[model samples]
Target chain A: MSSTASSTSTQIQLASRPVGWPTPENFRTVTVELPDLAEGEVRVANEFISVDPYMRGRMNDVKSYIPPFALDETMTGGAVGRVIASRAEDLPVGTAVLHQLGWRDIAQAEASAFRQVTEIHGAPLSLHLGILGMTGLTAYVGLTRIAGLRSGETVFISGAAGAVGSAAGQIARLLGAERVIGSAGSAEKVELLTSKYGFDAALNYKDAPVREQLPELALDGVDVFFDNVGGDHLEAALDVMNTGGRLALCGAIASYNAEEPTPGPDNLSALITRSLRMEGFTLGGHFDLADEYAQRMTEWFAAGEIAYDETVVGGIDHAVDAFLGMMQGQNTGKMVVRTA
Target chain B: MSSTASSTSTQIQLASRPVGWPTPENFRTVTVELPDLAEGEVRVANEFISVDPYMRGRMNDVKSYIPPFALDETMTGGAVGRVIASRAEDLPVGTAVLHQLGWRDIAQAEASAFRQVTEIHGAPLSLHLGILGMTGLTAYVGLTRIAGLRSGETVFISGAAGAVGSAAGQIARLLGAERVIGSAGSAEKVELLTSKYGFDAALNYKDAPVREQLPELALDGVDVFFDNVGGDHLEAALDVMNTGGRLALCGAIASYNAEEPTPGPDNLSALITRSLRMEGFTLGGHFDLADEYAQRMTEWFAAGEIAYDETVVGGIDHAVDAFLGMMQGQNTGKMVVRTA
Candidate 1:
């Protein structure tokens, strides 16, 4: 095999498994030597590496809907990259592409697995990973399919400043929701939700007790609750949900790391009284709906009806920090690592 | 202003609210003279009264989807009765009807509030409160509407011997569920679930640990979990739920009498992992779907594709004991009181 001499690659692999919360010790930085492109294989220099809450669940060895990340393997994620070399007719060199390229500087994969991105639509490449990609689809399917969210209904979203929640709020508004309320842990996040993301209202969960603040924020009561944080936030949402409310259980970032799982508040009987519907979902489960979501999201983005934000870290070495920070609610929007 | 000479009207009122679990002392039996029927009014002798778990939440003076039961007032419930006198054209004497007659022997109400129950159907009057009424509707809506249950999905129901759970298991089977598993409190109740209600398997939760037994019973893993008891049963169901599973939250009998709300199991994070959907619901909230459910249930019952059981207590004086028995898991099915 003819080897490539100039291909650059920087990657992060899982050094060890985390017992509780992940630390920098769990990751290892490695410089990989790139191989020559085989037939139908392409080399991608990643521009933006995505860090998400779902990754934490994969770090554990327990069985889940998706398999856990094996120790010493490259930590995979959604990434936007520029094609530097290609041996396929469909994708030529210099094309911008999006793929599941772990926390890496460069990658070599079959060209069919990578989709070519075009700026002809006047959208940024990173948008492929945030508002126009899995994050956007997650919000769409969870709200429309799982929650059965109807137009003119009020919505409440937890972790409202993060990637999926941010996309969810804007998408909810575009779908003709009457009102959208969001909860984040910081004042800046609260502000970002309402002002930048077009949320009707946003609350800083840290400043006030969520149980009390939820009712005040949702005076008319919530019709749909999109929960990303599952501990106290779920209980608060349960308290304020109106009869026949739909709770879209998207994520539970709040309780991912404890040595023992935290117990939810004892208002479960409310389900029977209000006739609420709470559901959990993953983007991978709704792959069948991808085409439909992509069409709607592309149309919305093209019309300027929806917008997205991202916090891009500088290098692959900082991918672990970015992942950790995202889990700690430190990022304002979608957290991504730039490796190229 | 003519008044009836008879003092045959007897009512049971909430004497005092219970602190944790209710007792017989919380109820009071009272006899009052009947009033003359006003315009559009009907006087009915209640034959059967329903004692349900939802009533426990109503005793509390807090804001809920349904109003709380006022202290010293008759406790309200769905009851079957015979109209003795009427001043409205829609309802006439000797008509068998269904109405929300609080725990009372005789009640006066507008004729519009009651629905005529024709004996032409061949179903018993008590079926209006159990399989043919709200209890059956609860099961239908939870499984079909809320859970979006599909054919061949494996179903696990808690409180499988109770009115709602019993109906849910049978309906799930009739809807083409591949396997229906149920958990009840007694060995005899478990037998009823399998032999009578058509559940593929049934386990007496009081006899063994459900967490261990659940995985064994649901060999293919559970796709829809119809939760009636919400403490450990809910937690156990969460553990075994398949990817994209849906949990229909019907009731939480386990936590109804809990003085302090029990903390939910630590395994709730599984919601994110499995992409499970858990929703709480009340039959009244889905009233819009009732007509459809009624039609389906009637056809199913006529075809002998479904069956129901009820534990009837004879007389108003036995109402409290019957309710206590139902709560203590003594009743094999719905607990109802027949008053003369």
Candidate 2:
């Protein structure tokens, strides 16, 4: 085995399972010396480690679609990097790659562990972690497949300033939605939803009850609800949904940090009254549409029709802070750690 | 109009909209002199008036699939009767018929308003209000069309001793469900579900919390949940649902009489974790399958594969008591007012 004589990786590991909300004490920073590369191994320096809401679910020691993160181990998630050294035939030096080795500065693994990607018009490598990657795909699949959004229907997306929600709002408009409404936490994000993301109306959920505000904006009733915030947002969507409405349950950031289970929508009887359908899904199950989505997204990007934002924090040491900030609605778009 | 000079009709009228649970004061019994039948009118003496759970929804003045019953007007619903006098050709004096002019001893309406239904091998005329009528079709639609129950899947039903729930359990088995479980408010109803309705297991919801007990009974997880009582029952179902499970929301009797909206399941996050689908529907939208359901139900009844029970309250004066009793979970099966 050929060795990298002096390379070290800075990583964040789960120190303890969070109770209610996570804090700095729940994580531990570890520095590990890189080992010798095997015959087909590669050494990659991560550029940006993605922080997402779904990752919070994995930190808990519970059964879900994806297994829980092992305690006292490095966090594993989406990251974009450049393979600086390799023993593989296909992926040589300076190959930009994407891998599931997040919350770290250096990733050393088998060559097959990383997927090669190209820089788009000299854009930042972190673009692969947000709009052009899994985040965008999550939004696309939720609108087209999970919600079955049809042309000329109205769409309402919660957490509209966040990664998937921002992508979803724009995608809904492109899908021929007659009207698009969104809910976000801050006045700035609410302004951005209408000014930047093509949302017809936006609600600053922090200002007033979502249920009260949604009706004022969605006067005709919502035809589709792409839910990223569950709790009150879900109840609000139910309150103003048209008959035969569809709800795509993508995330529940509302109760993600709750010590006890949060009570769901009070008017679920609307499901029966309006003959509604509500489905929950994750991106892992709908990869069949990846190729098609990539093609459409690239076209949309080239035409200057798609817009995205990112909130990047510097240094690997700040990854925990970045995650906590994202969870607390501090991020306007995709939250990513510039590990490099 | 030629009058039936000596004949009279006793009718139950909605006195006012109910605030919470309805009491006898919410209804008023009135006797009216019968007017003579017009050229196309018929005077039918009702045999039985169906006092169903859905009727409670009509007592509230809210927008729904069906309009609320008008105050000071006779309540209208499913009723089976025989034509005592007819001014039309299709229906003779002895013809058994069905119509939507219930809560009355005599229904005198245009001939076109009543439907002719033949007695099935000496079965009581009231059977048309239950197994051979809308009640049975409700169960069939929830299982097949709404939940999409396939052969060899496990099914769970709430309010299993009630009309629709009882039929759903039997029909789920007939559709080749591997197992059928049910929950009822009393031990006797629970016993009847297993003994008479062919349920694989039955839960007396009064005995324990449904969420705690469901896990012990539904060890393998529930695939289809036919919900009639939708408060804790919905939460319990969410707790034990398998991946890709489906829920058919038929009724929410648990909160029907509540002055305020009921909080839904706290564990709705299970929808996303398990990638589950929940849908709500009423029989009105699925009436296209009514003929198919009726054919199958008659066959099941003939072959002794379908069992039914009715809590028949004698006399028109006690009709309010029957409805109140059914709402309080006093009935074992369909509750009816035997007017004849």
Best by DockQ: 2
lDDT of 2 by residue, B110-227 (tens): 9998999978895788889988899999999999998999898999999999988998999999999999999999889999999999999999999999988888888899999999
DockQ of predicted model 2: 0.87
- Which window of ten consecutive residues has the lowest lDDT sum in model 2 chain A? A1-10
Residue A241, candidate 1: Cα error in Å is: 1.7
Query: Which residue runs of candidate 1 sit more than 4 Å off their true CA positions?
Result: A1-5, A120-124, A288-308, B1-7, B37-42, B85-93, B120-124, B288-307
lDDT of 1 by residue, A57-140 (tens): 889898877789988889888888887788888887778998886788888899988988756356667777887888888999
Worst 10 residues of 2 chain B by lDDT: B1-10
Per-candidate DockQ vs. reference? 0.63, 0.87
| Residue lDDT tens for model 2, A24-124 | 99999999988777789888889899999998999998999999999999999999988877889788878899999878899999988899997789578
TM-score of each: 0.91, 0.97
Task: State the C-alpha lDDT per candidate.
Answer: 0.85, 0.92
Most accurate candidate by TM-score: 2
